[model samples]
Target: MNADIKNKIIKYSKEIGIDKIGFASADPFVTMKERLRVQQENGFQSGFEKGTLEERTKPDLLLPQAKTVISIALAYPSKMKNAPRSVKGDRRGIFCRASWGEDYHHVLRRKLNLLEEFITNMYPEERCRSMVDTGELSDRAAAERAGIGWSGKNCAVITPEFGSYVYLGEMITTLSMEEDTPIEDQCGTCNKCVDACPTGALVQGGQLDATKCIAFLTQTKTMLPERYRKKLGNRLYGCDTCQTVCPENKGIDEHRHPEMEPDPEIVKPSLEPLLTISNKEFKNKYGKISGSWRGKKPIQRNALIALAVFKEETSLPSIIKVMNEDPRPVMRGTAVWALKEIAPTAETKHLLQSFKTKEEAPEVLEEVEKALADLSSQGGMYV
Candidate 1:
């Protein structure tokens, strides 16, 4: 009966646009718990994770009498169709492919809810709990155990059909079912992802130092550390370098879900305008995407860094406006750094020096002083 029901659930999943589905016993993720402990002890966690280790690893804790875990994967497009170019005067910043299109949280949750309803109708006495990425259970671990994909060295779930370009979600159900065999590790001696990581965030195969990961760093609300500034490149929300360099993900561009399609202008937006985007405008533009979950400040902050990285002289006026008029200390401080990098001219030095007088925020003032010191060290009259 469980087998028949399992087959029916799989069929229904495909009908509802679930790209991949698999089932596994709802056993505790013992190995993941140990790895998580080490990650926490080493301060490698990104502080975005939810729940205690036990709650994260034990399915029964989340839903009593859980017997089977059903994992689902939805493929997203990797290559942007009609992608706009980022030319010199019009430099652009990027949100990672994961943030493309509508927020996967909403998309995946909707699918999960549909699956839950189907299961309850089939077995009215049985109970089920569903969760996406935000849930305590490690989606990748559940997916891996359920044979949705093997855990890649880049810390992504690599599916046979979708490569690593898939979003995962799962449902823990009380009904027992035969479990699918887990996929064998296919990444033999493939270190491309680790070797290509800009911040050395990969740490080692299947492990990541989330603190240094640009993907995690871009989502942070605080001022990005100076060491990781240049490493950010033009990525405003997340980093895709690790996945992009992986041989498995090479040439894998799935357009299975229309909702996951990216609008070129939105994902790779011009940098300068972001610096002064009103909150309402930011929301109206990026509110649907997952990247905007942390709000517009981080995206705007990264835009300043991207402009500085390009040394975009055209954006100097905009950056200066932010330095002088922006209320946020992080924005003002970041603008000061952008000014120094973009154009450390006599005018810029004078502006910083004068701004120092009225800049009451210690952090912003510190950035102003630092910019002035950097200009002085260049051995110029700007000092």
Candidate 2:
């Protein structure tokens, strides 16, 4: 009876657009508990993780009669079709591929709801709980246990069919089902993702130091540490270096779901315009994507850093304009950094000197002082 129901569930999942689905015993994640302890002790957490260690590792704690976990993966497009050009004067910043479409939380939740409905219909007495990324259960851990994929060294669940470009979600159900075995790690001798990481976030094989991770760093609202500014490159939201450099993800571009499609202009938007985007405009343009959950401040700040990385002399006037007028200290301070990097002129020094007198925020004032110190090192290059 369980076998028949499981098979039907799998068929229905595919029919409802779930790219991949697998089942596992709803046993406590004993091994994962140790890993979480280590991650917490080392202060490697990104502070965005949900729930306590017990809640995350124990299945029955969430759903009293849980017998099996149904893990699902939906593949998203890896490459943007006809992506807009990032030219000299009109440079654009990018949101990572994971954030290209509608927020995965919404996409995966809707799919899970459909699966839960199907299960309840088959067995009217059946009870199920569904969760996406923000849920108490670790989506990757559940996916790994359910045989949907193996946990990669880069800390992503990599499926043979979709590489690491899939969004994961899961449902805990009272119905007992035949469980699938976990897959073997195929990463073997490849260390490309570790070596390619701009911030050395990958501590070792299958471990990540989230604090140093560019993806985590990008979401921070305050002044980005000076060291990571250059490492941020053109990324406005999350980092994809680890996935991009992984051997498994090579040539993988899945565009099966239309809702997962990206708008080139919105994902890789013009840098200058982002600096001045109003709250309403930011909402209208980016609210649908997961990257915008942190709001416009982080994205705008990242845009200023990107302009600095490009040394876009053409954008200096715009940078100066924001530095002088923007109310947000983080934005104003970042603009100062960008201004200094783009060949600070005598006029620029005068502007900074004048601004320093009126700048009250210690954070913004510190940035002004640093820019002036850097300008002084140029030895009349700006004078």
Worst 10 residues of 1 by lDDT: 374-383
Off by over 4 Å in 1: none
- Positional deviation of residue 10's Cα in model 1 after best superposition, in angstroms: 1.0
Tens-digit per-residue lDDT, 263-347, candidate 2:
9999999998998899999999999999999999999999999999999888887888899899999999999999988867787
Number of clashes in every candidate structure? 0, 0
TM-score per candidate, chains pooled = 0.98, 0.98
The 10 consecutive residues of candidate 2 with the worst lDDT sum are 374-383
* Candidate 2 residue-wise lDDT at 152: 93
Error of 1 at 218 (Å): 0.7
**TM-score (C-alpha, index-matched) for candidate 2:** 0.98
